[model samples]
Target: MVATTAPPPVERVAPQPPWAAGLSDVTASDASLRRFLHGLPGVDQVGAEARATMLATRSIKTVAKAWAIDLAITMIDLTTLEGQDTPGKVRALCAKAMRPDPSDPTVPRVAAVCVYPDMVPMAVQTLSGSGVRVASVATAFPSGRASLAVKLADTRDAVTAGADEIDMVIDRGAFLSGRYMQVHEEIVAVREACGNAHLKVILETGELVTYDNARRASWLAMLAGGDFIKTSTGKISPAATLPVTLVMLEAVRDFRDTTGRQVGVKPAGGIRTAKDAIKHLVLVNETAGDDWLDPDWFRIGASSLLNDLLMQRTKMATGRYSGPDYFTLD
Candidate 1:
């Protein structure tokens, strides 16, 4: 029975890169570190609603200023309903809303206007003179369930339509099924399709159903060359929780530590009130530090949120409350 052929030499998989190793550590230890991580203290825990109200009122003067500044820097990404956002409508809205008045220097322009692929050209043309970017949701947005060819074509078309940023949704179904490689490859392919446009991979954490999954998705997206990792699609309920944001920001921080590459984070959906916005800002500051607090690294995707923020700011600057229609929206 003698001469069994020698087994072919085994191929060794390369060791994890430093960045990968660091991310692994961050995700691995997140559970234990949960209590220490930054988050909002419970208002209910203050013994009574009346006491909480008193405490909240005392902080209003200080918090109002911070809220105003943060609001001014917010990027309202409007992934509007198809027919609701006609080219003429988008153009008029951009023209009126994005113009910076010298007298209102405190009101910073929004970072970008995010829209669907069909509306990208309109946004690009409308936002051309203004410094605001035209972002398109591509790669089967809200649910990235499509053939690779279809997804790639979608991404290519969005970039061709003058999208400065491509917000592509990841294959959550694959990721949830434990098909991490498939998810990673898809992100890489879409990122490649983006060309010069920045790639913002939407994890849609609401569907991930677990904080661990969100962190893993965040790491995988960043590893596969995502310029930013965003939260929800705004179509889902229970969107953009503080714990989820904490986990994603930690992923960004860890990825930066490992690879020296900085990635942005966006928390979208259901983030309407000014207090909620400030809490997000506080989370970003405490977790990702001051550097990530800028519009480049952070954004809040909201339609109603901006108006509330503008109202709060108007109240602070002029010491009086403004009506719901303070900032016109066409």
Candidate 2:
């Protein structure tokens, strides 16, 4: 067989890294990107899980638990991405997001309502004037299987529809195959498509196969100007577990320290109850500090999590569990 040759390198300029007075872009080329990502510290998987478990098990005082329940409500990206989702369903979800508990007006609205790109107009119309943002998943969500032009069009359409945020998935195939520049440029291009909207870069960590890849993907997303480095697309198994989130929390915490720009961390999928949400809040506080505890700096992407949070909030106030009839179906 004839000798094979690698593809020619693409010339790209990554968004400038957050820097102090005397620094410059460190990941301007493919070789430097590989060096930079590879050079970052590796994760201790067993230790990370052990610590995540230990932190998850920590108990909060009754008073603090009540506070956490509400905070989690405020951070939820109330989502509905089913194939059969209709305009009426999107409107209903928006209504739930704005009020959460119809009888108890004290319950705060969610941070945003996450939906597919096609449903953005309905979401925007329904959530208008309410503080809840409309977040659309783009870049061939769940699979990240599409061309750059398609992904850019996906992002722009959502933004034009008045989506306040765009959740974009990175090309995990390129990432896993070690084509770092390909993945980086896609994120940069999508970030531009987002325009005034915030960009949440979904790593879909379950496909990444290792904690090291998750950590590297986090740094890569942050360096590429992702306003948030999210853990998953909420479409795969093992989505948003505590251990995976712990590694991401550490990555964001350290990234902020190095660059002085704090990027958010969101763990989507598989988080379905009040207890699980609280555990993540504790993890964020203990691992990333209280600075990340706010809705502005952190978000939980889920479909059923809001109902549980409302139920728990009611239980806290009434000292009894609210039956299934108390809340609408997710």
TM agreement with the true structure for every prediction? 0.79, 0.92
RMSD of 2: 10.6
Candidate 2 residues lying further than 4 Å off, grouped into runs, are: 1-23
Q: In model 1, which runs have C-alpha deviations exceeding 4 angstroms?
A: 1-60, 63-74, 78-83, 100-105
Error of 2 at 276 (Å): 0.4
| lDDT tens digits, residue span 1-330, model 1 | 001321333333343453344344332333422321222122232233243233333233445455535554555564454547788767765654475322366676777887889888888888887888888898887777789999999999999999999989988888787666677778889999999999999999999876767777887788788999999888887798777787788778766766678999999888888777776765666567666867788887766676676777777777888887556663
lDDT of 2 by residue, 94-202 (tens): 9999999999999999999999999999999999999999999988887989999999998998999899999999999999999998998999999998999999999
Candidate 2 steric clashes: 0
Question: TM-score of predicted model 2?
Answer: 0.92
Worst 10 residues of 1 by lDDT: 32-41
- Candidate 2 residue 279 C-alpha distance from true site, Å: 0.4
Cα TM-score of candidate 1 = 0.79
